[model samples]
Target: MTTSTPAPTEAGLDLVTRLNAYLEDVAATLGIRGESCSVDLTGPVAARMRLNWRLPGFPERDVDLMWHEEHGWSAAVATHSGDGHHVVVAYLGGRTVASQPRLVARFADSLRAGEHQDCWPGPPMLRTAGGPSALAKELAAWA
Candidate 1:
């Protein structure tokens, strides 16, 4: 038997849609060809979602993106091997370069080129945080 996940709220859906569109544009700008790429709404109240993309001759990749009205945005890329992960988070004073399409494009380019050294190409402010649950809680309250 399978359990169904509830649909996200309209507000949640809208934010995810916007983020997805930004990434899609970034991919296009970088000339990263993919037969199909899409975003999944993972946690609406948490303002969480994920993007999956697969370029020709390569395995797919997943990137978790989240947002908080006060904190801005954050991104997490989980290694396919399930052994490691990378995170890009908001900076001091609640500033974030993570939402910039060009930066995300560079990250995708680095991954595609196999030049990702210990999650290089990340923002200078990048660091590991307590994880999504905290952000999710914060977003839930705001929602």
Candidate 2:
């Protein structure tokens, strides 16, 4: 049987919705112009059988996105189980420059605490959405 989450009534969402709302606040900054609270609604599942199916893959749960006007998608914090699977959140303009380690550090707890942060196209790849998924050398695996 499929896992059941609370269905949102015409008036409001279930617990997950409320939590995402809270996470969004912690992840985003004032300088950023956009604030989006979204979910990768696949499952509250698992992600590693080491490459096997038996290894319950991580579920696709809710992730918070906090965009900085000066930066891009600076943070992406999750509320439940499958939390730190993502690396970069949202990409900005068309020039991925100035994404400092300090900035990414600020977004840490917000974007899955204990996860590593890496910007796609850290230099010239700044302004594009999903600037590039090419893993960074220094990355400890995009948490």
Candidate 3:
């Protein structure tokens, strides 16, 4: 007899749901206001959560929270650049999500304690930046 395995997307959906909730709380704690946050779990490679916010004078910005299957989670700020013609995605932070609940809790704790900022990055972004973020360093140290 042969058995079937569950789709990775099934897991992705559950994780995305929990992550969206976490992001909502994180935004509230940070005092970020505007449209509520939501995660798009339509694809396999990446799940994207987005929220809109505006400062008094500057234009509204879209904050994107992305989860990459292999690379884990990160945040990005999307907005029109100074040239006023181009939109840009400013990289923020990332961390692995091997243990969904554990990682989510860790992120919540860190954010609550001001230990991990949204500007932190995971390994891939660390390589791009030629260095690691504080959270990444901490994660590595413990590993």
Candidate 4:
């Protein structure tokens, strides 16, 4: 017998849609062309985006951004080991998990300008109490 994966619930689909739109807004705020960025929402409560943005000294490395229901947004770089791993480099450090797109854009700009703070070698601990449902509700206000 074969078992198939469960389909996403309507709530989960709505959350993904909102998250995708938010990432698009962030790209617009940063003046990044659509082709230079990509967002992934395959997971139930997490999302990831990749920007064709390179730091001044590391022109070959692309910037990776991720958001979780609990941890919000964090920036990272793909590890050099070719093992499909990323190293967390900076956290948005905001009070809420779902911050305004403009604020997230500012965080990206800071990273580009080499002035970012809140650097950590690993992903930070949970920063928000609300889970996916709460995040979906918060994003609903953005509509």
Candidate 5:
């Protein structure tokens, strides 16, 4: 029997490129090095960014920001575990997909001050179920 692999969809590629650019914007807004930002285009499409400064109360732990297609943006502390797990501290709960870089920087600033009031206890509820292509369309207007 012969098997063939399917090519990556154009929408998926577009989403990846756009998401990478978004992460770069976020890093620039926060004054973080570009190398500290990364995006995972597989599955649900997610991005992770590491801040140079630590969280206010937890001086030893590093702060990280994450974004998911279904959950928007979140802040967490990178745990000591080498398995890449994090302790979620807050969720930036307005839009379920994307938030502007300035808004993200503002959120991070609030987190550093230990006075962030806009945090949601859990990840934001899903707003769209159309998956990658849908997310790409939504991110199209991101600037």
Candidate 6:
């Protein structure tokens, strides 16, 4: 299986830009109080991509900002991938949920639209329920 690393490229940055704009709009729609939603500056990608590609019922987390009193994050989004940026949502004092509905929809849209690269972990790595892969382990880690 391919590691979750993406190649750094201008195209990847493009995806990140779209994510920033799209998230801004979503935050406005729900009147996201405060700057709860934002693009992470320290993220590996220059910007975050917002594509409607993801499973249903997942919530979006502003990965841009992670807060940990113990760890004390001093920046936004901390994932290191060439895919541009990962949606950063730091609820509950700076923990992240990988399977947020809003985030999934955005990612799924990008995948379906062919705008972003296919970053699925692939086969044994692709997350699924009882599909004989790391899906169970990954999901369990989240729980």
Best by lDDT: 5
Which pairs clash in model 4? none
Writing each residue's lDDT as its tens digit, candidate 2 over 22-119 gives 23333343222113223322332111101011111223433333333224344332445554454434332333322343453354433343333333
Q: Compose the digit string of candidate 6's lDDT tens values, residues 1-143.
A: 01122553554444444444444544444344324543433333222333222323233322332222122222223345545454332221123223333554454344334443433322121222232122223224322
lDDT, residue 99, model 4: 77
Q: Write the per-residue lDDT of candidate 4 for residues 1-143, one digit (tens) a residue.
A: 01122366877567656666666776677676545444444443565567767766667666677776667788878777777577777888666667788888878788889987544445555555454456667677554
Off by over 4 Å in 6: 1-8, 40-143
Superior candidate under lDDT, 2 versus 3: 3
lDDT (CA) per prediction: 0.42, 0.31, 0.40, 0.66, 0.76, 0.33
Q: Which stretches in model 2 have alpha-carbon errors above 4 Å?
A: 1-12, 30-37, 45-143
Worst 10 residues of 3 by lDDT: 126-135
Q: Scored by Cα lDDT, where does model 2 land?
A: 0.31
Cα RMSDs, all models: 9.0, 17.1, 11.0, 5.1, 5.4, 16.3
lDDT of 4: 0.66
**Which stretches of candidate 3 lie above 4 Å from their native place?**
1-13, 33-35, 44-86, 97-143
27-90: candidate 3 lDDT, tens digit per residue: 5554444243433333433344443442223346554445444445554445566331323232
Per-residue alpha-carbon lDDT of candidate 5 for residues 1-143, written as tens digits (9 for 90 to 100)? 01121356887677665666777777889998878776665566677888888888789998889887788889999888867888989988885466888888898999999977878889887565476678777778552
Q: What is candidate 5's CA lDDT for residue 2? A: 14
How much does candidate 2 score in TM-score? 0.24
Q: lDDT by residue for model 1 over 1-143, one digit each (tens)?
A: 01123466655444444444554554566554322343334433223434455432344555544433344444555566876454542222133423455665555555546554534233343323333343333334223
TM-score of each model, paired residue for residue? 0.38, 0.24, 0.36, 0.74, 0.87, 0.24
